[model samples]
Target: MLNFFLVNRLSSQVRILSSLLVMLLVFILVTVLVKVDTSTWTMEFFALSLVCVAILSGASNVLTASVFGVTGRFPLQHSQSLISGQAMGGTVSALAAILDLTIASNVTDSALAYFLTADVFILLCIAAYLLLPKITYSRFFGLFSYYMNLPDEPTDSSSSEDPVETVDVSSSKTNSPPIIPILKKVKVLAACLFYTFFISIIIFPTISAGIESVEKYTGSIWTNKYFTPLTCFLVYNFADWSGRQITTWIQVPGPNSKMLPVLVFLRTFFIPLFMFCNYQPRKHMYEVFFKSDIYPIIFITLLGMSNGYLGTLSMVYGPKVVPKELSEGTAIVMSFFLGLGLAIGSAFSSVVHLI
Candidate 1:
């Protein structure tokens, strides 16, 4: 909700750069405070650090909304690029965790390296945003400009008295235009997005993380330590990234196609697949139908792939379906649906874990 408001209030570049700057400051402060000795003021510093973390977390959604708004202006292929980049970040994080696990011995040293690396990355992003306007295509597309509305076009110039009809890009503009009509335009894409993420999040990290190798008792480091990270996180993230990249070249089942929703709803089957994997410490469900490691690797990979493909397709198609003026609003609405799906999925995941 805050994201929707902030995106409209500020330009895309401004909001993103501002958020990145704040995050950079928070990171520096946290690094300084947490490294200090544990004195009477330790708790005070810790509390302050938590508050800073919360602020950064709160600003994250706004940053996301702003970026999506910019991409919403351009062609759908650009949106696919942004989606692919996001998935690539996840893949990189998974790999970095594996690297940290292999090399870092002390938790303090590991955390220090982690936060410092993040700070540098934020700086890089800030620089990138500063340089984005230099791109010819970005300028040509007016990516930074807010589209108020498209000019009215007449169907027949000779027959009509006034060929080009006047559009009410009103002088007395409200904070936003009528939302009901906009909602009606992107309703199907929104639903597809919600269900896709809902299915993806319901089983991921909760049930999937608990899944163990069938050869757990083998006692090898590969099976005990590296198996889940490699097969689960790394593979899923890589496949997801691949799926997003594929959208740039091949966006099958077109924007208005009915097959899109059918394919999205079919992803619900992945939930049961993950649940039925070799989940450890099986308390309630006695059966583990997928008895081999290969099953989980395949299942998790497919889950991530489908999630990336369908999720990206749905989001890119959102702005395309609406009028130029309403693209920003529809983009924000699509983001809301995506978040709503994640929220609902997170809530359901807890229930699945308990059961």
Candidate 2:
């Protein structure tokens, strides 16, 4: 029942939600149609296509991450790089939507199957790229550097300090280092993981179920479920773009702004909820689910918009909670939590369908 076309006024939060909604709706509908006949394709052919898409998407995510990381780390012109990276990420999302839609409509059975597979592959690839080697190195080094610099620790007496200055090296050693405050770090990591896990639990299952319902009732298959990925991609991008705009332009009076965190949390929760509510199972739901199709489409659009805004805000503000040096590391940990959450959600959703 959500109004799909209503353009909400632009707050930092609203701007994100609106964009996600618009992009997702367009991409999901178009992809669904394109994927309709892909069941006719051979699995081997389909898989090859998927691999190609995965490589492309993975490369894009890595490039975006690298740009952002390098820019953030640089002493000079960090802001410009950061902005450029975010913009690029947003552009990727937009491009993905367009490609998915175009491919969905014009592609033949074999072609559609290959395309869908590729999209999924790309998604997984992006995730893998985000998770592997560099994540660990960045996180460990960042945390290590932070902990090594704690003010609580006294200078080592062996190096040379006056007698008064040399006092109580033992107490200083017992005190945690200044750079990465262990307690704060733990709390942030825990919060990120917990939120990611729960949200994933809600989202993945709902999406899988929705796809299954579409397949079962509509007589579609995996390839025809292109809408799922398209919707996700668009929503993520739109929310991200909006968040960047909000944070950049809207400044609060105080040194610490309450708006950022509040907006970020709102962005995070709304998209999943929007998706869930739209696809909520009803009696004979499959029979009636696509009768109008309009309702779900609207939901998809809204979900995308919300996601776009929230994602962007989270990316921008995520590092601020920790030290500058540890930003990349924090991002890696957060990405891990996100991946784990998505995996668990997908598994659980599949199980629910079997039941």
Candidate 3:
């Protein structure tokens, strides 16, 4: 909706710059949250912070996609970079949490350390964005500039030879709404994205957070204490990063293949499967199937890898399916759908206890 309103009024570069400002604001907010005593904070402050993060995240997605779309030359590799960055973020957060558990004296110290690390990364992003347009190669391709000169596609003279074809082309151009056409073109991509995140978000962070190794297992105490979280978050991040990296080598079963959505939908099994995997809530009712800690480790690794692989495929392929002029808007729309999947999946995760 922001894109609908602001795409015409502001250049993509300006919108992206505005998103950077929003990110900086978020980092500042995190800093304040960390520095201020927890006793002074209330639910309202935390709620407001969440609201701010959601809005800024959506804005950033729109602006980034807009820049890619408007530039016309940015390719799937660029989209891959964005997806890889997201995976990297999870990997970093996981490492930070591990460090916090191992080294931090208290929860407060851990929070402070995590927030400071995040702030530094946010600053680095701001610096990179600031310098992007100043460098010639980045200016030409990385940053979207209204004045960037691009060669126009050569018109086909054969269309002029046939009056019916010319009239059909003109009429089609006149009657179609720009966004609607692109949306139709990339409908499968949107659905693929929705399912990918829906399956992932439903099981991860919520359901996965509850799973633990059986007490009867003879693994080390640290492994028993931290194994679930490690498998759910840290191992997941590493496996996810590996899955995303694999795409760079092979993009098998290209975007148009019917099998992609099936693969995504099949991932729904992980929810129930993870739920049954020595989960704390149901440990009494269902006997632990696999006594060894290795079962969940293997499952989560596969889950994370699938999430990264399918997600990267959807992100990179979605834009390529659309015309270059519409790719940016299409990418943003894809992001919106991806967020929708997460929203729906999160909502479902909240209610899984009723099941």
- TM-scores across all candidates? 0.89, 0.43, 0.84
The global C-alpha lDDT for each of the candidates, from Candidate 1 onward, is: 0.80, 0.42, 0.71
lDDT (10s digit) by residue, model 3, range 178-296? 56666777788789888988888887877777777666366775657677557778999988888888887778668999988888888888877777677777624466665666778
What stretches of model 3 exceed 4 Å from their correct place? 38-44, 51-72, 139-177, 216-220, 283-287
Candidates 1 and 3, the one with greater lDDT: 1
**Residue 268 of candidate 1: its Cα lDDT?**
83
lDDT of 1 by residue, 121-166 (tens): 9899889877777777776776533332323232233443321122
Stretches of model 2 off by over 4 angstroms after superposition: 1-67, 74-183, 189-236, 251-302, 321-324, 348-355
Model 1 scores what on Cα lDDT? 0.80
Q: Is candidate 2 or candidate 3 better by lDDT?
A: 3
- TM-score ranking of the models: 1, 3, 2
Give the per-residue Cα lDDT of candidate 1 at 241.
95
Least accurate stretch of 10 residues (summed lDDT) in model 3?
168-177
